[model samples]
Target: MTDHPYNEMPRSDDNQSLFRPVAVGGRGLPGNLALAPMAGATDGVFRAICREQGASLTCTELVSARGIRHDPGWARSWRYLAITPAEQPVAIQLFGADPDDFDYAVRAVLEHPVLSSAFAIDINMVCPVPKVVGTGAGSALMRDLPLAARVIRSAVAAASGYEVPVTVKFRTGWDAATADTPAFARMAEQSGAAMLMVHARTRDMMYAGQADWSVIARVKAAVSVPVFGNGDVRDGPSAVAMLRETGADGAAIGRGALGNPWVFAHAAAALRGEAPLPPPDVAARAQTALREVRERAANLGEARGVRESRKSLLWYLHGTPRAAETRRRAAVVESLKEVERLLADWESSFFDKNGAVHFT
Candidate 1:
């Protein structure tokens, strides 16, 4: 495998404060490392795995507040909001354009026995997807600050009754030309948001280009509440660099955590001025990938689970020998048995005479 800078140690003094507990309303996270919510990736099973791997906090995929308002029985949104005890200190994220929808959705979540246990109710104003933005939700809210404030207030009012904190996640602005995170941070705080998470990219930038972390520092300066910096924090050194540079209370891992939950452990260790554990070997990666797929199959039916697991399996197999061919085979796997066989074959092919495995 190519050498990665994540394996390097970060300067101790610059990152000493990176691992402290952060308070959000009544909840206190054990550490500042959080697994940022990803819609298609962070399911209940994967959140549990991330938590075990060292994420101090995890969030569910963004659920539609309007959808929840319509499905009082949670028929459509249960899969997205499902949380297990193993993933405690988890947050349930909601997205919607209307204040009334958030009011209704927050109450419904608190009334439900299972979901009520979530550590916080996170409002999504960072998602840049066209479908979400077209509805005046997600990053579109950044363009309408007045409406965003009302939405935050509505959710805060609804959740405060249940003693649950309401947090907001947003981008710098619609684009670099209009970036104004400091102003948005103050408005959210005034609207009763208990904490803030700032993704340093604008909606127009989506996931491309370098993240301007200076925006996070500006937001941190504008708000008294805990703020997490999200964007491009892929490993231990990057996590420390974000904290040191932005003075953010935490670093939230989004795409960085895909198929590499160990990023959390490594970040935590680096924040504590220690060396990170070695990266997982081929055997361990194969086993964990198989376990995730099996658990997904148990929760969702086999067909859907196998279909959904393809991307994650490929992520885990990345950098292994013959990864291109293996990933091509993994993409068309129709059954769990086929997945198991594929992994076994790949693992067997990599082992040398000394029983050591090499990855490219």
Candidate 2:
């Protein structure tokens, strides 16, 4: 492991406590660990698994406010906003450039029977993708503070009537030269955001480069609202370091949580000043992967679910023996049965004459 201080395990006497409940408006999260909203990776099944695995809060993937306004029946957005009862305290994240669309979208969410019960309404200003940024939404809003304030005001106003909190997630700035996250935090808080989450990279950096935790620290100092630090938080120590270094109220795990829902459990343990559970063995990884595939199959039919699960299946097999070949076979799996056969064969190879797992 690298000698970075953040990557070092925390000691029992490290004054930096990582776990705590955060109050966001009328709702209260049981702990500070949250699953950051990811566009395609965090499906309903994965969200539920993360919740079960110890994520105190979860967020739906980014949904388009304009799409919600156009499809009031939720015909097109249901897949992204689908939150099961098991994933309670989930937030529905909406992204759009227009304040009017956010106003309508927040109202629409509050009116829906199932969605009305969400823990909070999260607004996305952190996504750095081209399509989203090209439309003056996502991180593009960072360049226009006035418009960003208006959008937050619109969402907060709409959700206030239902006693639901509004949260904003954003990058540090449009680029390194214009890094003004503290100012952005103040604007969001003044605009009535109940909570703020900072992904410490600039729009130009996208997902590359080291996230500057100093920005998150500045943001926490700038706003009274709870601040959650996201980016590069891969495990317990990094989560703790984010809290320790930034004084953030929480740590939000994004790519770190893919195929490894146990990250939440490990984070929780570290927050409690305890040793994290050992990493899952190959059997455990395969089992969880199968469970996710089965649940997805049950929800979205076998053919589609298995097809969609290809990437996740590959993630589960990462670092294992013959991973390249296994991933190659997994890439084109079109049915649940095919996945099962592939996993069974792959798993069996790990066993010896004694039926015990033996890694070479």
Candidate 3:
């Protein structure tokens, strides 16, 4: 069991084990749980924390091939792909429509000291953010299967020689209005995708509505490569249900992980058919958040760490009382002392809803 610091981690009995090792491109992932590459979230620090909590694999935030080609800041752009020895089995996810750029980017990444730690390469075909779609990247790739194939072939060619597998993550289609993922999945497999992840919703659906697991089922039927089901998976039961419903090799955890890394451990246990563990109580959450703040401060420095803490900090207190005011303070506070003060105030207020504290 991991040194969870708060709760007693559960053990997996052989009979109840829901997970077995999964192989991707000749590399075996310890388990099948993956962390989705959310743009503003899942940076190196957060990725390290989540991996420590149990996510078996993680991909970087989407890097733009065009940016890699023209921007002198390309080195800085690889920040999301930065890895420590502990964050192994990470993938470098890239986005763009230019096949040439895909080739150039992959080769360049294979040589970068910071990014050489990637275990695989993943192309993003599921982003719904208008900027990404308008540029004919992201979900736009879904509309042009031929262009998508070209991009994948280029990336695969560049990496296959090095034995680095390339994967793709995509949504069903533009929306519920059209679902073409089965055909798309077949094309990607033929194009040399080592694995695939289906988000189970259309690009137009964004993160809304229920993720249609039937689409994952369709994609799994369409290809021989491993398929991971994404979207709407919040915890252990949902993770197990995704694999069972679609016959997917595994499930990907996205928004469900905000402020809760333990979901990975719980999901792993739940896969084994164990009881779903209880959520962290207020004090436990407060303490964990405090530790994360220290990690952030040490890794990212006080100013940026404190500045960014507001979002994740608020996420930790998502449903608790006095959350609104704390969110406002967390948004701009600039010191570990300030963060500690806020956590201290919350601990005092955890049982006293009427209690209030003001930031200095």
Model 1, 35-90: lDDT tens per residue? Answer: 99998998988899989989999999999999999986778998998888999989
Model 3: per-residue Cα lDDT over 1-360, one tens digit each? 123221121233335455766778788889889998888777777787789878999888998988887778666675665667666778989999999999998988887786766889999999999899999999989999999999999999999877889999999998666668999998999999988999999988889888999888888777778788899998988987787777778789999998887789899888877777776666777877887778777878888777777778888877777788887887787899999999887777655455543321
Best to worst by lDDT, what's the order? Answer: 1, 2, 3
Q: Clashes in model 1: which pairs?
A: none
RMSD per candidate (Å) reads 5.4, 4.5, 6.7
Off by over 4 Å in 2: 1-16
Q: Find the 10 residues in a row with the least total lDDT in model 2.
A: 1-10
Per-model TM values vs. the true structure: 0.95, 0.94, 0.90
- For each of the candidates, give the backbone clash count: 0, 0, 3
Candidate 3 differs from the real structure by a C-alpha RMSD in angstroms, to one decimal, of: 6.7
